[model samples]
Target chain A: MQRIRLLKDRIARKLMLSLTIFSGLIVFIMAFGLYQRSRPILAIKPLNELLFSTSWQPSSGKFGFFPFIMGTLWVTGVAIFIAVPLCLFTTIYLSEYSGARLCKWTNPLIDLLAGIPSVVYGMCGVLVIVPLIKDHIAPFFGTFSSGYSVLAGGVILAVMIFPIIIHVSSEVFRSVPAELREASLALGATKWQTVKHVVIRKAMPGVIAAIVLGLSRAFGETMAVLMVAGNVAKVPSSVLDPAYPLPALIANNYGEMLSVPLYDSALLLASLVLLMVVLSFNIISRIILIRVERNIR
Target chain B: MDRRYAEEKIFRSLTFASTVVIFLTLAFILATVIAKGISYMNLAMITQTPKGGYYLGKEGGVLNAILGSLYLAGGATFLAILVSLPVVLYINIYSKKESKIAAFTRFSFDVLWGVPSIVYGAFGFTIMLFFGLRTSLLGGIITVSLLILPIMSRAIDEVVRMVPTELLDASYALGATKLETALKIVTRQALPGIMTAVLVAFGRGIGDAASVIFTAGFTDSIPYSLFRPAATLPLAIFFQLGTPLPEVQGRAYASALILTSIILIISVVSRALTGRFTRHVVK
Candidate 1:
């Protein structure tokens, strides 16, 4: 019986090992396949030109990534700018001010938004925002500038990233151990003060991670931007000016291309750029999260 | 004493205002979309096609587009589970304990999740082109599976992490071995979480407009097979708006709302599931 049990254990161990390797290999294969596909433009010299150069004309065979990169950055920055303050304060209200019933309602309400289709967001942008801009705002700005502009895209994206930021920030605030809050109050700090000094301070890293996650999401978002953004493939002079994002560019143009290696390469290059922007944000958040984890530990 | 009393009033009001802003922002968007979509919709307008250029008048029953969207998204999401479950179980529960090899393997998925969906679409596109599956349902399924994998994997990972370590120890103590324990005990306990993950993944894939556009192409026809191109709701909305016909434009809004409501419902249900699972696990 003992011998049979030992044999069974060894077989299970071997099977588990094989399964793990197989699963992990699929992830590796998928990632490497992407890397291989992008290698042509992702190579040093061409990528440098794409990144630093300021020109973009596909017909002219000139593709400078600066405009798209800047567009993505500005839009992402705007989204973060709009989302963070709103999320932080809302987290405060929910964690500190709200009754249990309100807390229950708000938490699920926020998470519900996280699941909304990006296409719906686009619909709102089109039916609501476009008219609001075209009929109301664009008149003040100029006639040539249509409703489709960075302001429309960035603002719409702000609404899109709002739920994610709120949900994550709320979760962090909720996790800040009730004992800590009680300790601060016992020390004579008031409700708002305790939240500001003790609760927010302790949860700052996690809050920052949430914001960064929201920013990365804004940067890499493809579909909503595709529809809302005017797809001019240029850097915007202002939020009211039109621009293109890397994800939008990739999604819009990649399918239409014939087997031109350079076109395919450019699309891959676009992916890598979007990947790097998102990865850097992720890496930054991961570092903060790691530090936060260590501090909590 | 006067200063302290005044400060209290101001601070309380500030928090109150902030709460209102968050609450209103969400409420405004939801109410506005529902209002706009419903206003544009009428039965005949839905059942008929457009006359003027796109965006001019609402027209046509989005019957074909709606059906196509459901079929493709549903099929792709189903196929994703077929491949991802075993993969997730292997990575999460079946990995060797305390092994450096296991850590490296885990890192691979971390990197995979970080890769953009467009990269997956492009890679899938490359393969599809090679196989002559351009603009077909098969291509859409592969692209969507890749897109959903990271999210599905992450959700499954969360569930695996939630499975109490003590349960595993107990299972092993019963002489069930690692595989049997994971299959019977850990996964069983984590079923709700796993299901929620799959539901969310399905919603995400179904809601995706960009990934399926190239892979599935825009087809009003419901696909008879994997070889046929199928237009999901998001793609249909995109194509309809792109057209010059007024009726097609109206069809876009109706389709958009349908897709949005379906995804919203799925998300709400999954959110409830996750909340319940967490509460149960905590207890």
Candidate 2:
């Protein structure tokens, strides 16, 4: 009986180990599959041309992803610019100045914002932000904007990513040693000075991780951006100009790829690019977060 | 002295303003969705599937989507839990605290968690092609299970890691096997956390749209089998919002409201249940 029980234990341990390894294997398989499917496109089109060409007419065999890449960068850049200050300030307030009552209310509210689906954000953008931009912000700039521009995508993304930045940064700030704040204050520094000079500086690495995570989310965001980012396949001349980002390109065209030869491969290539970019960002942020935790010890 | 005080006042006000803005944004989103959706929300919307000409701005409800979302997310979350429990157990119970295999697996899960849902969709599409499988509920569930496996496992791992080492030591000292201690002691201690992880994964899987768009081709009727195509609330909202007709667009808002409510309920219920479970926890 004792020997039988020992054998059962060994089998269970091995089974669990294999299951854990299987989880990692799935990611490898995904990357391999994407690479295999995209090889045909990679063979026909030089890497530089496929990545740098401005024209994207798939029917004409012109599959430059440059415009979509630029669109993604511009939109994500704008979102980061808009979201960072707001998130930073909110985190500071919550961590340094807010009373327990306020923190109690705001934390759940932020979680609620995080839980809301991206599709709902897209719907809200379509109904509210899009028209608000078209009628107000666009007209002020003297540009004939349809509201479905890069700016609209950025604005919605900013909202979508705000919770992540705030949640992570607040945790970072909260972890700063109380002694650091007291020491700053003991040196005749004001509360704001303590937060700005000591707490924020100590929390910088975690804050950067938060921002990187937010940026990754913005770059890969699909349904919300697709709804607002007027899907024209051109590099936008300005924020008000319509543009197509890579995820939108894949989602919009993947279903109909059979009509045009090599289109499927091109779309697969786009997915590969997105996967690589997102995976790198995730790794960089994870390294930073790990360092932050190590330093806390 | 006055100069320093004035600077502090200005900066404090700015932070306060930003905090208020975050709250206001949340309020505005909820208000808009509720105002637009309340009119069209009815029992029929939750009870009946889409009828003929439904996409054409005609009659019928989003019952198919409601049921399909529940089915797909429920199925995926169940599979994820089955896979995740063993992985978490292996990491915390079988391996050393800083084992390389455990560290590498955790890192891979972090990367997988960050990969966008659309990439998963594309990857699922590729797998389907390789196997000559068409879009179906089964494909969606499998792909979604992959998407949430990392999330669920990571959450459970964190909780399991927090279990007091003394407790495990005691179990081992009593001549219990590693598997028995893991199953009997650690799991009971981490039950609440495990429940929360499952709910979070369920919420994520149900709300996700990009991951399912290709693998779970849309339908207007309830999918009777895993092999059949299924409609989901997120996709329902997406398709409805794409229509040029005003009524169909209204349906989009209604669908969004339903999805939002379900997520909100899940988060709240999980929080409450987690709190209750904490009371019974060893820690």
Candidate 3:
């Protein structure tokens, strides 16, 4: 019986080890596949021109991705600007001020928001936000408006990433040692003062991580932005002007690849760009989180 | 002292206002979807498939998309669990905490988790072309499984990490093997979390449109084979909402309502189940 048990244990151990390796292999395969498909475009298009030029006429074979790149950066920058302050404030209230009853109800509601489908956000943007921008905000500013523009995409993205930023930042705030809060209060600090000075200072790394994660989400987001961002492949002059983001470019044009000479490769290159940007953001945030965890220990 | 006091008051009020904004945003999204969706929702819409000119605003229902979403997400979640469980177990049981391989694996998962669904669709599209495979249910399942693998694995990994090391030590002291301890003790302790992870992945997979739009190649009829293209709820909404007709746009909202309710149900059920298991957990 002892020998039989030992054999069983050995077999189980080996099986699990192999499975772990297999998971790593899947990541490798995906990266390899993306690289292989993107190679054709990379070989033909000079890297500098592709990264810097705004012209993207695929039909005539001009595959400059500069405009889409700028579009993505602008939309994501706007989203982060809108999301971070609100998320930080909400996290402060939830972690430092709210009672247990309020936390219970609001916590689950936030999770539900996080679980909401992106396409639904797109639908809402189409029916509500786009019109609101076109009919009210644009005319109020005395600007010509299409409603489907960079600002619309940014607004929808801001809503989508609110839950993520709030969740992460709140967790960071909650992890600050209770003793720190009490000591600050004993030193005659108000609740808001303690949170601002002691709690926020300690949680800064984690909060940065949260913001990075939210930025990563905004950068890679597709459907909602695609539906609302007007998909004009040009460098926009204003927030009200239409723009085409990188992921939107790939999604919108991937289907018609055969009609253009290098369309498939161009789209694949866009995917590779998205994958690299998102991966770098995630890696940076993970490093920050690891440092935070080490400091806590 | 007076300036400090004023600053505190202003900051506190600002945070309170932000919290209210968050609540209002949630209320607005729910109200818009529900109000617009309810008028077009009916029994026929839920029970029948598209007939003729469904996209042209004629007639039919969304049963095909509903059923297709179920099949695609269900299969993908099942596949993800199969791949995630053993890897999670390996991390907690078979590997040491500071092992380079373990650390690297976790980092890779974190990166994968951040990868967007559209990129996954592009990746899947490339692989399908390489394999000479067309868009079908199988393609969607494979793509979505990749999309959710990191999510499910990371959730399970966190839960398994929380399993007190003392329990593992005790099991070993009793002469139980690592396999036995992991399979019996750790799994039971982490069961609720694993279930929650699966449900979350399911919700994400079902609601995603960009990932499956090209890979699944939307169909009006419910797919009967793995090789056949499948319709999904998000795709259904996308197609319907793209129409120039008003009634079809209403149908799009109705589809969103159904998708939202399915996700809501999964969230509630997972929370209830997790609560039940919390009582048995050892801190």
DockQ for model 3 equals 0.74
Across B1-283, the per-residue lDDT of candidate 3 in tens digits comes to: 9988999899989999999998899899989999999999988788989988888887899999999999999999999999899899988888998888789889889878889999999999998999888999999999999999998999899989989999889889999998899888898889889889899999989999889977988899989999999999998998899889998888999999999999989999988878777555666
All models: lDDT?
A: 0.72, 0.91, 0.90
TM-score of each: 0.87, 0.98, 0.96
Question: How many steric overlaps are in each model, in order?
Answer: 7, 0, 0
lDDT of 1: 0.72
Best by DockQ: 2
Q: Please write out the lDDT profile of model 3 over residues A1-297, one tens digit for every residue.
A: 999989999998898898888787776787789889878888987878888988888889899999999999888988999999999999998889887689899999999998999999999999898999899999999997889999999999999999999988888887789999999999999888899899999999999999999999999999999999998988888888888999988888756886888788888888888888898899899899888877777
**What proportion of the real contacts between chains A and B does each prediction keep?**
0.47, 0.76, 0.76
Model 3 chain A poorest ten-residue lDDT run: A22-31
Q: After superposition, how far is residue A147 of candidate 1 from its true place, in Å?
A: 1.7
Question: Arrange candidates by DockQ, highest first: which order?
Answer: 2, 3, 1
- Fnat score for model 1: 0.47
CA deviation > 4 Å runs, candidate 3: A1-4, B277-283
How well is each residue in A230-286 modelled by candidate 1, as lDDT tens digits?
878777887777778888888888654555546676776677666666767776776
Candidate 1 residue-wise lDDT, B175-207, digit = tens: 786667766777778888888988888888888
TM-score for candidate 3, residues paired by index:
0.96
True contacts kept of 2: 0.76
lDDT ranking, high to low? 2, 3, 1
Clashing pairs in 1: A151-A239, B46-B60, B46-B61, B47-B61, B48-B60, B50-B247, B54-B244
True contacts kept of 3: 0.76
TM-score of 1: 0.87
